[model samples]
Target: MNTIEPRSTPQPHLTLAQADHQDTLRNCVRRSLNEYFRNLEGEAPNDLYPMVLAEMEIPLLEKVLEYTRGNQTKAAEMLGLNRGTLRKKLKQYGLL
Candidate 1:
């Protein structure tokens, strides 16, 4: 007879340095936003969401593609994105 065993939950294996780096990245975004708000000089912000997403997405895709040596499948896997979705983003960002 064959028996199946229950699976245990997987744990993330982030190191202290990685955690610190994550915090640093958050702080950098916070600082950049604060600077942007300051520079607005009483003008209202417009389309901030898409602006930030585009700014972040371009470099993220570029670096990941570079890291994977332009392999979309591996890059999508690393990004937890569907390959087609990654291709759409690549095309949207004019990287395709």
Candidate 2:
């Protein structure tokens, strides 16, 4: 007969040094994204914020809905939003 070994529970611990390192990493990523956006704005002739956000959100929402097999409830749960809100966004983006 084969027996399975018991697995130990994992401990959750965050030391001060680890926390500081995480904060530094977060700041670096924020700085890098900000710089990238600034460069994009400089290169583009028109204001690109809304256009960029809409373009990004459309494919992202479609992929998420597809991953949930076109079920809005599951997609909303995965997105941490209410079903109504997800439906509204889908309609607004003409994906519904």
Candidate 3:
């Protein structure tokens, strides 16, 4: 079977007025993290790495698999993960 290529990263097509907001992904991440840290109110945060990855990874995998139309190999290549690793994650997420 021919493999479906993953879609290219989305490009913004905003008007001049909309562009002024500067709502890019980097800014969004920065804003979100800043808000998260601010909400902690001086409490020491622990396991942030795993926490962040766990939060992001599921949606990342879901989007990639959806882009690849449920094809494991192409999704793996697109994600820069080995096929087995991708399969494991997919299985873990109940996608497979």
Candidate 4:
């Protein structure tokens, strides 16, 4: 007879180094935003969301693709993107 075992729940833990890294990321984003507005110098910024997303997305997709060695399945898993979404982004960025 086959038997099934109950699964244990996962315990989440945050280390001090992880907390520091989160703070560092927050600080970097804050600094970048400040610089962006400063550079505007009274000019209004347009399409900030799309602009930032595209800028960040391209490099992220490139790195993830490289890291996975063009394995879409693993890359999608690492990126928390569905396979279809990952494929779409890869195609959009012309990496596919």
Candidate 5:
């Protein structure tokens, strides 16, 4: 006959401590952002993503046009696009 010791159950205090720590981190970030913005003394923040995309598209279209030497049909072909579709995108993006 052999006797085995029973394993002890895990405690919940560790899980609660982790949750509290995460809450503290969130509050710290919120407070820091508030303080930083309150001390701002400059121009307003801009939507950088859209602005960058617009700036990039202009040069990209120009380069594609140059590569095709101003030939819309060949440009569309080389770009693997339908000519009319490319024309529409160009017009929509104000590049036409």
Candidate 6:
């Protein structure tokens, strides 16, 4: 007897606009990183991962909150974050 394996869920499909938005974001990050490295002036980078995340997360949370009209639930849902986590981030960023 052969055992059946469970199939993995299919990835969500992105619309044209979504794809373009992703590409635009990628280009922006690439350009920013290139500029950042150039301006490093032979100094070693430090805490780059957190730095990039903080930089991106601020604008992302702000835009999502604005789009959701200050509704934490909707903003968290859109950002794939828990409502409590969103609130914590808002407080951390002084956006609360």
The ten-residue window of minimal lDDT in model 5 covers 20-29
Error of 4 at 54 (Å): 1.3
List the candidates' TM-scores in order: 0.75, 0.53, 0.66, 0.68, 0.43, 0.74
Which pairs of residues collide in candidate 2? Answer: none
Candidate RMSDs in order: 7.0, 6.6, 8.0, 6.6, 15.8, 8.8
**TM-score ranking, best first:** 1, 6, 4, 3, 2, 5
C-alpha displacement of 11 in model 3, angstroms? 13
lDDT of 6 by residue, 1-96 (tens): 999986987868988766655657886897799899999999999999999999999999999989999999999999898999999999998999
Q: What would the TM-score be for candidate 1 when compared with the true structure?
A: 0.75
Tell me, by TM-score, which candidate is best: 1
Clashes of each: 0, 0, 0, 0, 0, 0
Query: Per-residue alpha-carbon lDDT of model 1 for 29-79, expressed as tens digits?
Result: 877888999999999999999999998889999999999999999999999
Stronger candidate by lDDT (1 vs 4): 1
lDDT of each prediction vs. the true structure? Answer: 0.91, 0.81, 0.84, 0.85, 0.73, 0.90
Which scores higher on lDDT, 3 or 6? 6
Q: Measured by C-alpha RMSD in angstroms, how accurate is candidate 2?
A: 6.6
TM-score for candidate 2, please give it: 0.53
Off by over 4 Å in 4: 1-23
Instruction: Looking at model 1, report the run of 10 residues with the lowest lDDT sum.
Output: 18-27
User: How far out, in Å, is residue 18 in model 5?
Assistant: 40
lDDT of 3 by residue, 1-96 (tens): 999987898877988767655887666666778889999999999999888776678888999989988888999999999999988987887777
Output the TM-score of candidate 4: 0.68
- What tens digits encode model 2's per-residue C-alpha lDDT throughout 42-87? 6753655676568667887999999999999999999999999999
Residue ranges of candidate 5 with Cα displaced over 4 Å: 1-44
